[model samples]
Target: MRDSKLIYYRSGCHSANFTTWLIMDVIVQDVNPAISDLPCYWNRETSKSVGLQSTRKLSCLWNGVDVYLPFNFIKNYFEIFGAFSLNHGVKEFDVSHSNSRVLTPSSRYNPREEFMHFASFDVEGRSRVLCVSAGEGVPLSTQWNPQGYFYPTQIAQFALAHYSVHSQAQHRENIKRYTIQLEQEDTAARVRDEDTNSLVIQFKNTLEFALSSPHLVLSLDLKINSDIKTWFKVQLLAEEEGELFTLLYTQSGIYIQSDGSEFQFGFGNKASGRWLRLTRDLFTDLKKGLTHSNDKKKAKKLKRTKLKVISLKFYGSGNVANISLSDGEDLRMFLDGANWFLENQDENGGWPSNVIFNQGQKKYPKAAEIQPGWYGAMCQGQAISVLSRAYHVTRDQKYLTAAEAALGPFQKPVAEGGVKTVFLDRYDWYEEYPTNPSTFILNGFMYSLIGLYDLQNISPDNVIVQLLFKRGMRSLLALLPFYDAGSATFYDLRHFTMQTAPKIARWDYHTTHINQLLLLATIQNSTVLSETAERWRGYMVGKRAPHN
Candidate 1:
């Protein structure tokens, strides 16, 4: 089986599964280039011998030998060794690894488009199948071109060569207990009872809680009489900082306000004479408040160790009881998200988005757009990642099974009710939004790849997953250069459909791209990935690529 010539191609028939492999002798023409321009990481001799120029064409020796690609081929192999195949008298082959059928190339894909580039291909039968591309060509140098511009294909090639295989890190153990202590700050205040279960305070009295982890839940019950005309307030003080939050129960209403910090949230009126049970996730509330505070200093400080709640000072008159603090609510939320995937996944192994998306149609009049009930590659991939972690934590076969099942829609085509589309009839791409014209979203595709990595780690022997992951990786490597826009990254390749200005990612999405690239860099050990991440990071601080 190893000796047989194997070429995986997609038929023009959109409903055909990606299972067809034609046994053909592929003879690719060698295009030699100067070694001085090769990426710094490439061995010059190796680059020279391979003729690693990005403008080679292929000559196919089409033999009708029908040899199927076993999933194990993907398991043992990890590099592709060919210059991209062009229009060589054959129907465009859909090499997308999943058994899923793929959408027909949208009319947007111009096969005869003028701008054509190619990557190197091996003439010997022992080609790098894992490092394959369809028609996309990576740049020779990993560095920016003379115009300070780089392309996705270059970054993709860099990742394909260096990407490492490793499992996702185990989740950190959740902290179990947190202790609270009491302190009387103002002598003007008096406590009627010393017991934690029952306390009546006047003026200012303080309660201090030790903090180990940030996933904190704070709950307390308080009662105030009509005599509290001024207000009964619990001032939450952090250990290192000034007062953090003010929990106030007034005759008018209940309010959560930041003191030295700058956020305020109000809840409607609570009757004075009744006991009020107040429960809050302090970490979430504090994080949200601080983030919206729009004060960078406070926001930066929030990243530091969450200060122990040093004091909860009481003002005016109030009775306190059943005060409690607990840790590990964050993990609870994480598990909750995973459970949602388990419960909500469709029979087709996809999580469906019921809402309609018209953003492309609304923004770009030229875009072939909008649809309801689309399944996103990002959702599938991220859910799998979450479920993989959940499986690790609980050792639940169900979570693993659900994750495995989620690969279903990936095998089908967008035209045949799937979340995948082939770019230019060659590169495999999982669509975030399955629009009429493909929107090759950068962040979503990367996230889907990350999820594949996680699933592959737990179920290492799953052949289907192996092919899906490696093929997706190969496609991503070849496709990277297209996402690069010199100064910033495009949110998606919608410009191909819209024919409008490229949609530059917002600062937040730009940061997400940087973070995702950094992770991929660590996975691939690719200098190109790391450099691109760093360069994108610099953009947030006003850096821009020099225009041609």
Candidate 2:
């Protein structure tokens, strides 16, 4: 194991075992499960309870190096980890500013809302690559931001409950960061020699993704299966009065395995160590899932399904031509889930609390609200964001109308200045606690609007759409204390470019889409918006995307 270049991490332990998924571990210390004589997790100091804590520190030695981890992490570490961190993350790029780095094999980034960036990329060619990281939140997200009063100290990745990474994770813009070396590779190099040379790149977990696109038809995902065919693509259209999501497939084979396999995926923030365990578990089990199914026909069927699952395309990276995978069936499910979400949507034109089914009926949970000040409105705005995406993806006018209806009820000024947000109660559910709302719900509300606007190209007449496109400019002009040009990067900057100061925090992977929207919106009307359009067009025309 000492000389082994391939390293695997599960629950933070370097495991040579291929069976483990590279998912984050969950730790719990018991306050004592009095009823079952089980351990209890409590802080003991504040009379507060904590999860399980094991003293066992495990490690998988590699290349004379030891990667260690603590035990009792299944529940204490992995299970309770947050989906992603809310910070810009720790990535070190060369001084050039154009070159970006990846944190782990399974990681993506969220610089601001509206744009999607990679913590790092595992490239197979100049273009063929994969990013196993997530950005902090949707576009215009400032909830977890430090300067934002509501979640001021909540920037770390580990602090948030159920957040896979640590809370309070932030980027020190003043300092140049560097990615740690454990299992690292230059994706661009892979992209450079994709056809002549083949590589099997491994991420933090068992997840294995191979990208080889010589031409479209001959592309390879995991490994080059000399004997198989796989391709699934999509075409969106607006029918009679609704939108449709069309799934097309070119080739496939189905398969089933003997042993049960693990599967999971996540996106949000880059610094989040989420990819480690999940990828580990997924790739290992993926191969295992094929054990019993060597049945060529079965393999073909599964392959087809996998292709279709990956076909839903979005403008990935910084350009429109660089199409990348959207969140597959889950992305669609987000829409389907809205059907159930609609009933629970607040009477206002927005969503209610995010529902978790229990007795079969959809629920609007008032308990999760941190403060009584924001509740109904919080749920409502969230619903519109989802509904809008559903409509955009499916081209469903019905869904768009549903989204409009949901947001209609709660549209009120966020804090004044004609900057409106859905009103949400900040009161705690049981009345035992009171949490801050003004800043918290406000960010959520704005984020939802920004997210909806990210899909504006799909529906030009969206009421929320125009508001998002034009509001920030007016908001800045109104001069809200929150508009920090020095530290912020909003999507609709083009609309404000001529009015904005020269220095901007270049967050490449941020709400770039909103940037895209502005660039595309103005690119067509370059004549009228010449001064503003020229600067905005950098998103497309300018090759160098300044690093934030």
Candidate 3:
């Protein structure tokens, strides 16, 4: 596919799926005036020519190709060819090797969109296909424009190029058919057949024990154009007595039977051959033995909680956050991501890569100078979360100690770190305002306190936690006077809305409003919360014009 598209196998297989790819044969240039006036290569010393590249997308060439061994084509190929994303920062990579699909929004995704039942496929009887991803274009010269961009490429051997299943209709059925609406209390996912994905559910505790209290409901009209069937699979096993499944059809539809059950049916676990006691007991006993063994990490005595902390906010609207939204599980995701970013943290503690997609749109143009990075503060907030959780759960001083290390780089002298300077323009055009920061830079500082709050929750000896707490308080207090209290919006300063564009990317306002909201609701600091929110009232509101 020339544009963004997923290439999963309709044949139902995991290894059998891969998105349509674009391949480029790149040749790095020499002494090209870099985009935004930044250096062209990762290092000026390395005489390499890196430029834009393309992939082949023809279908017939892959008639006989099999899985040639999995290779890190990036280091082996792109690095040799000098292809990389210079949209903002010069992160190195083989352009051909790095292909990614933007994940669909939750409202239009599978499970409700499709059953997500597609599993690994058996390919013994299946055939193999490969797309070379070569597009159309021809180069006439050696030098590129001042922006350091490359000309479009031509498919030289397209008729003879390695091709795969080709179709101009690559995005033919890409239209989404339904959307997911949240439940009334916002506890469950519901799908509206006629509505734009009307998905909702309410999980109030049922006084009954034998049956599950959280019943799945389907209330909607399905607008089917042609022949189609809807199916649902639910399993509540082991200690749970009953499992329920429902299929609601808008039309008088024929039901496909697997076990010959009629249109409406339900099933429960049967003891006839559920499991032999010996076998069940054998696995259970083995699991118990393995718990304390050297193999196990934390013994997982309490299941280590697969369910993590979830905030019950109104999806997309970002309106008033429900104060009661929480899942009591440790959010290890914030931790894992934080640790990964920290591990890759540039000396500035900020990740300098721009995430190009906006709202629901996707656009691509390479040159590190254009894409802005907000990773530093995002990672910082995430680090604080992880450190707090690790310390809270285990009372391990090491985790707190590790958390301390997370902010060290950000605190390093700004005169030396690249983070202190956010580029205003290529010729150094416009003047940058004081609060105009790279988004994640400020967020890192703000979230450190959040992580500390998490840590303070369970620490009995809370001394170190107290120290971090005080440090956070002082830093936050210092920020109050710096806030543009009169402004009513938040936005990234790097983006060029019209010179007359409204202020929406208010970086500090976003961080500050959220911080105030957290403190007011979470810490019960209602007095300060009112003060902060009062100033930010214009920024944090419904889709209304900025009321000065």
Candidate 4:
């Protein structure tokens, strides 16, 4: 038998109940010639060939010539060469005596699509055979088997190469199937599945891009699926060397990270039935690893990590119908919002006191009766600060003009447009809205001062605005002595006549107040204000020395 071929032989036992016979054929060559010398055996009572132990070499007369056959080959023909055949090219092999059928070797396998072929044979004695081919152009099977010894490293290398090729092909197909358009930026890919009505917009190399360009915006357009309020699951998928990271967006603007960590933000409120715009500065924060961990050094290292965005999936009962990609709004969103405030400003150069929600009338009957146009000092001050920022960013004269106009209210008395005040000789400062009998809200006063200061920074030539800002700062400093000296933190609201009120203080108000004081210190170059800011900072961070 040739090394690449196989053969089998069998005969039935001469028993009345067992009349069936089985035979198999195999041919093997290029093997050790010593295999021909083993013994063979037969079972006389059963009339079946069994062992290969005989010293005699069986002679077969073929075309009048005697042929010597190996006893080992005859005895264990199936085991040794069966494995050899399997290793060579066969994908499958089976043997049967009663149900054997012949299969012709034709082009049963298409070369373009099919990667394998199979064949079956039925010889005499009701024997059936099966063989498989690994298809055209495939390398001669080098698979290791017990019958044949081969280099394990060689086999492993071949298997790995095959797998790598297969994996690359699969990756290409996946990209083709999911990709809808590669836009001009080349950084983003828009993918849509029409059948599922789903869309995925992916930003390629998200971590790298975000780290270098922290100002870049990431935006998504969410078209509501229904009128009934529901929370749609928004998912961000990212991968690095096959390691996956996921972030889930929940209704309350909470982001649940892949490692079970969570962070919250107010990017936008989730609502139904209208096209909602979602924007986040958190992507840059995420790339920096600031949201994932508290260690600044580790977070900074993570900024350089290579991570690719796999997809962004918005899933609800209804699938994401469409997705579009853009470079995002960044600070421009703030600019636009400030412009909205500018557009909605009252003719008297102020924004409405508060936004009224008629929908709240369902729960509160007088919700609709709430007045809509009574502007407060805090509101006008903040509006001035926003306009100043807008003007700084865009260099738009319109923002500056609007800001100057908004300052009109603070120039006059409360009976007019300005906030009412009373001068305190002890503090050498003016108290705001002195006509009111209630406690003085620190946020309302401090925030208004911040806005005025910010506006003054931009309009240094305006003497009236500068004077008003200095007066407000003096009042703020005078009020500072009433706060606890040890903490350098004030109560939520302070009494006008009385020296003390509730000791309650919120971190939000504390931080905002400290920041405003720092801004004032920077603008005025005042050592006193700077020292005060440093003291408050030390207090907030628990690093302050024992108060003297």
Of the candidates shown, which would achieve the greatest lDDT relative to the real structure?
1
State the local distance difference test value for candidate 1.
0.52
Candidate 3 residues lying further than 4 Å off, grouped into runs, are 1-375, 396-398, 413-415, 418-445, 452-487, 492-502, 505-529, 538-548
In order of lDDT, best first, we have 1, 4, 2, 3
Listed in order, each prediction's TM-score against the native is 0.46, 0.29, 0.29, 0.39
lDDT of 2 by residue, 449-509 (tens): 3434443544666666556535432332232222233223342222232243323324442
Positional deviation of residue 446's Cα in model 2 after best superposition, in angstroms: 6.5
lDDT-superior candidate, 3 or 4: 4
Per-residue lDDT over 166-231 for candidate 4, one digit per residue giving the tens place of the 0 to 100 score: 233443353211212334455544556343456544332231121122222344444444443333
- Distance from true position, residue 44, model 4, in Å? 99
lDDT of each: 0.52, 0.29, 0.28, 0.42
Report the lDDT tens digits of candidate 1 across residue range 447-485.
788778788888888888888888888887777778777
- Which digits, one per residue and each the tens of the lDDT, describe model 3 over residues 245-307? 222111222111122111211111111112101000111112222331333432233231222
Query: Candidate 4 versus the native: TM-score?
Result: 0.39
Off by over 4 Å in 4: 1-328, 355-372, 414-420, 423-435, 485-488, 497-500, 534-548
**What lDDT is reached at residue 8 by model 3?**
12
Best by TM-score: 1
Q: How accurate is candidate 3 locally (lDDT)?
A: 0.28
Q: lDDT of candidate 2?
A: 0.29
TM-score between model 1 and native: 0.46
